[model samples]
Target: MGQIYDLAIIGGGVNGCGIARDAVGRGNSVFLCEMNDLASGTSSWSTKLIHGGLRYLEYYDFKLVRHALLEREVLWQIAPHIIRPLRFVLPHHAGLRPAWLLRLGLFLYDYIGGRKLLPPTRTLDLTRDETGKPLAPGRFKRGFEYSDCSVDDARLVVLTARDAADRGADIRTRTRATEIRQADGMWQVTVQDTATGDRSTISARTLVNAGGPWVENVLAVGAGVNAKAKVRLVQGSHIVVPKLYNHDRAYIFQNADGRIVFAIPYQDDFTLIGTTDIDYDGDPADVKISTDEINYLCKSVSEYLARPVLAEDVVWTYSGVRPLYDDGANEAKAATRDYVFELDLPGGLPLLSIYGGKITTYRRLAEEALQKLAPYLKGTKAKEGWTADAALPGGDFDVSAVDALIAELLRDYPFLTPAHANRLAHAYGTRAAKMLGTAKSPADLGQAFGATLTEREVRYLMANEWAVRAEDIVWRRSKLGLRLSKDEIAVLDQWLQANRAQPANPMREAGARS
Candidate 1:
């Protein structure tokens, strides 16, 4: 007889990691496995906004909107390092949504969410405001600005997993849950390490299938539940291009097709514009931004911007399949973003499956999920809403103090550029110092892998954050991929593979030896 976990989760996305953190915090032993890397799926492919889905108001989903809106501040407070307030400038289109209607939606958006720190909505005079300069001349007269938050979506998941691991939860990446069964009053899960081809079986008192887009496949194939899938796969895509405007504000443009598009400032040197809502029926892993999607997004933004966005200007494009709960909506765009749970207890063993949740509401979803499973988890702590206040790893400082943190980094490391210090401050927060670790010069940080990424930082990611490959380092850990050449990336990949077996603290050891 082996130790049976209180919870076993089969997903490394936001929901699964979040639940793992909350469950373990509540005194339940937890184990979580991801098929590839953390946030490697739909979680990282979001529009990267923590918003209330204001358009959902038209669909009469006030509850979902309100829940998401309320969560915006809570998420910002806990992970201020990766999340910050962003102002969206919505230009009034005479041919599309009327100004009065937009005002009404903005009003509901401002009041329903218990907004405290975020600025209130204000009217923008496009004729005079700098935000209007990007739009075609004399085409629009009025606009409105409202508050939302932009996030480093991938970092959020990784940090959550890191926190869960710190709290005694067993977190494993590159692991797959192949088969699930019940025996001896415990749910048994057979997991395989994708890297080594080794298999092992573990027992848990309860199981969770937070597989996102693959939730159905896990239930029908892996768990053999013989139930119809309730997930609706919707493909949303985004394209990144050179920075469109000089200002910090983002734009939300209304199209003739009743869809909304956003052009947000991305990575300091580029602008991110995206997101189409079309139903998809293919493997979630195969989802990609199609030619049609790219053309459509470019045209959608071009309708408003003075400088037309063409396909040739796009530097990168990515897509993800949102596993929305199949609420029987006629159009994919109308599908609900609210989460739904299906709990099955066969032979007194519990298995819970989750469907359709957005990043903004993941914490609330986790809290509610634990509440539903409370009866099954004995002696769990009564910290129902602890996550709302607890800061994630490296995010313990005040949100307003980001500039101060950046200044401190530059003062401590005079060898660092302002841009490099800013990136480090946001990505690692107060813990940036831990990676720098008494370095006096750029050489002390080791080889520069381009774009301010150094050997010391890469080793820190591998040692603490489960970064295994170059893609994990350049793409997920940070977006240095945009700056690093292909040859540079390959060099990094080779270096990581060759040094895979080295000690996690090799840099510190080398420094001490000197």
Candidate 2:
């Protein structure tokens, strides 16, 4: 017998981490386990936008649209470092959706979800606008510019988990929940550390299955719940290419097939164009960008841009499986982005299984999950919607002050390049100084990996952010993978392996023991 937690979350995606943060903030003891690194799955593979799904409006998903639309500013305010408002250029195609319908959609998009800080929708003359320069000449005359926010999606997950850990929730990465069973009115979850081959059992009054694409697998295989899956695994793929245009704005182009693709600015040097929606039946872990998906993305964006994007132009491609709630839509693109929950109180224990949700709606989904489990979470303060006002770690400053913060970092760290200062300001917010730790020169930061990554930053990620492998630091913790050469990455990986004895954060240390 062991200490029974108030909540046990099985997943480390955005939804799971968000729920853990919310639950722990309400004074409930929580334990969260992820089979791999946080956000290594679908969460990191998003189009990187915090937006009201404008396309969902055509499917009459007004509720989801409004809910997501409202979260835009909320997320931006809380995490201005990793999340900020990004204007998008929507060039109207004469052969596709009508202009009147586009206007109606944009109107709904602006008003719905209690939009406050973001600018309202306005028409654009693409012929004169600089945004049109990248498009084919004389083809797109008029367009619309609207407000949405781009996010470092992986950072969002990591920070949420970090906040939860700071607030006393146990977050275990590289830990798998192998089996779940009900005993003595408690749900006992048997977990294993994937890295060390160690096992333990944790008991909880309530359990959450936030497995994303593996939601059904968790229930059927881990808990032996035999119910049919309520999820539809839809694969979405994206490709990264060299910067398409010099402008900062993103583009949302509509195709003849009624599917829309986004070409968003990424990492200051690449255009992230994606994502194609197709039915996926393979293992979620094995999902990868197919040749057709690559060709489709290239053709779709090429249809609007002056310079055609060929497969040769693709620098990288990634794909993820979205576990959409099975709504029986004819096409994957038409599936509902809204989430659904299945609560099973078998023998007086609460087990909540989540299916299908977008990044923008994860907070709301977490709040609702708490509401459903409120009865079981006794003696907990259960403060409702406190997360709305609470800022994640290092995100305490005002949203409008990002540039000021960057300048402040440059002033404090005179040796840092302007680009380095900007990256630190955006990645760590006010905590950048803490990571730098009074270092007066590059030597104080220890060995410098390519792409401005340093041994000091690497240690900070491992100790504070649960970053273990080189991929965790380069790909998930930061997009330095794009810049670090293979040799540099190998060296970093070797260094990490050699330095595994560095002190981990208190929560991580505790997680290892548990």
Candidate 3:
């Protein structure tokens, strides 16, 4: 028998990566496999907020709201580079919930989660506040401003996985778990390399199915486990348009259908408006934004914005199927955002399948998962809760130190343009220095692949992060896809293909598994 790992996790989303990071810190041997690149699934397609579900308050899900709300600061502290406070402007609609009720909801939101660091909610005068300047004349008079956080959702997942890999967890991307079976009191997991068509088998004492939308399918097809728990697939879609507002604050508009849409300042050039909850019945991987969903988002935002956003204004659109735990909710919007775990330890071998969770509370979910699996794995020194205060990779500095870091980079790398320097500092934090090395000019950074993307940065992503394809770098690792032309992208693709056969560094090769 080969070396049996303490845990084998099957997913590369936030939950899986979070669990791997937590479990590995506890001194447990962990092996994680993803069918595609990290954060390529629902993880990358989030509304990109580390927030308490404000709308969930209507359903009286105070526990979930509080839990998620508490995580906002915790996550911000740990990954300050990628997670930052975002004040949301909730404009009151006379046709919908009353202002007093909104005030009461904001009150509960402020105090329920041991609020600290973030500012308290306050009433806003739309006519006077700069936040309302983008709104139509006399359309909204009063609003409520509350605090949440914006996150680089994809970077969060990748950084978590990087942390786990750094701590000796075997992290494999583009590897699919094909079959799982119990053999002699251990889990025999068969994984296939999607790129090479190579197969390998590994044994583990425990298994975790953290496949977001594919959680049910992982249990039924991958592990052949008959699960009693059901997952409701809800499709949420978003569209990106030219910047709708000049201010930094995000807007949350209340719609007639009892749903709310958010218009957030995205990447300095665009505003991200999203999310319609509709029942999804197809493959999660094939999910795409529909015309109706796009129209709904445009119409939703048009109600408040000074200028209407037409379909022609949209630059990009994405959709993801949320695998919510089916709670018999009448509508997709009503589905619980809380996570549920179903542990099946048939014949003394454990298989923990996870269902339904939002990104904000992923760390808590991971801690809970380890606690449940602790009883089954004896003699394993798994630490209880340490992730709350731990900084993710390249995020060891204070949130206020980002500007200092940027200034230092600008001084050190004089050849870098201000925009390029700022982008690097924000994307990689202190690690940007390592990528820059002793380069005195842009030419030293190798060929430029449009925008500020250089060969040096591309090589860093491939060598350290599990970035194998052009889409992986352009789309998930960075949103440079929005800026790069098709021709530039084709050049990037060609470069990646040409460099595919090269051997990776020792550090990266150590964590990667076939």
Candidate 4:
């Protein structure tokens, strides 16, 4: 027998990382293994909104909405740099749901979670409001504005993993928990390091199957359980294109089919539009954004925009599946985003399975997961909901007070352009200091990789976060790939080849949290 843990997490997406952080903070030994990079799965391919999902309100999921909205403020407070409040403009159109219903929805949304930080909704005369300048004038008249939050979903997952590590949790990326079996009322889990092809066994009293799209498959195949819950995997895809508008405001469009889509401002020069929901089967790892999805998304957005968008306009695309709790909704869009916890527990050892979850609801999801496992663990009060006050890594600044901090950071780093400084602050929050390291000048920051990406930033990623591949730095850590060229990407790949560290030895047990 090697090291024993209180928790062994099967996935390294946001939910897994969030749970690991929660368990570690509760003074439990934890080991987490992700087969690929963190957020390499569905967690990164999100529409990237941290909101109550306004549409869910139509379904009358008041409980889910309240929890998600409350978590939104909590997350924004913890990582103000990464998660920030956003305003959405819904343009009133003819032949759609009545304005009275829309007003009622927005009114309830404001009051859903005891609104505090976010401004309340307002009616907008689209013809006069600045939010309607780009719209085709006669096609729209009135509109509504509401609050939500946007996030760098991948970085959020990584930061939670980082905090868990800082608190003494053992995290392994590019490692797969290949198999799990029960013996003596404890779990004997085998994990394989993909890079080295070495395997090691870990023991845990609890095994959390937090796999997102692969949750059911993991329960049935990997964890060797014949029984499982009702879950449906629905694939959702997002497409990024050149910025269509020049405002901080995002547009929430209602489709002809009564489905809604978002056209949100992204990465300074791009707008992120998405999410076509379709049933998916087969391996979650091999899921891809298809041409049909491209057409559907383009057509849907084109119907509402002044200048119609086409497939050729897309610069980047991402797709992933949502593990929705099977609520018997035949329509893919109608499936629930709320999560359900199922236990494959045997002999009092716990195997908790998580179904669907929105980015806004991860913290409460962790709390509930622990509550379900409370009886088995025998320490019900060890770590009871402390995330509200704690900041993740560099996110200690006031969420509303970020403008002043960004202004100060800009003054301190005169070499950084105003826009670049804001980008760094948003990506790393207060941790931008760590990314800068001791580089006193632009030259000292190492070779400029591309866009604002520098060698120093790369080194910082490798040293602190598990940034092993070029995509890890580009696509997830920062959206610099949207700005970098093929040549710049090649250089980072070459640099990683020469400098990337080997996966930590499975034989060598972790000594500290980080």
Sort by lDDT, best first: what order? 2, 1, 3, 4
For candidate 1, which ten residues in a row score worst on lDDT? 505-514
Q: How many backbone clashes does candidate 1 have?
A: 0
Instruction: Give the whole-model CA lDDT for all candidates, comma-separated.
Output: 0.91, 0.91, 0.90, 0.84
Better of 1 and 4 by TM-score: 1
TM-score per candidate, chains pooled: 0.97, 0.97, 0.97, 0.95
Clashing pairs in 1: none
lDDT of 1 by residue, 1-514 (tens): 7878999999999999999999999889999999999999999999999999989999999999999999999899888889989999999999888899999999999999999999999999999999999999999999999999999999999999989998899999999998888888888888899999999989999889999999987786456475454899999999999999999999998889888999999999999998899999899999989999999999999989898999999998889999999999999988899999988876777778999999999999999999889889874778575799999988989989999999999999999999999999999898887778888999998888888999999988887788899999888889899889999999999989988887366335435211
lDDT for residue 303 in candidate 4, whole number 0-100: 80
Displacement of the residue 123 alpha carbon in candidate 1, Å: 0.4
**Relative to the unseen true structure, what is the C-alpha lDDT of residue 312 in candidate 3, on a scale of 0 to 100?**
98
In lDDT terms, how accurate is model 3? 0.90
Model 1, position 333, has a per-residue lDDT of 85
Worst 10 residues of 3 by lDDT: 505-514
Q: Write the per-residue lDDT of candidate 4 for residues 151-249, one digit (tens) a residue.
A: 989999999998999888999999987788888678888889999999999998888998888776667655767555777889989999999988899
* Pick by lDDT: 2 or 4, better one: 2
- Point out where model 4 deviates above 4 Å: 378-383, 502-514
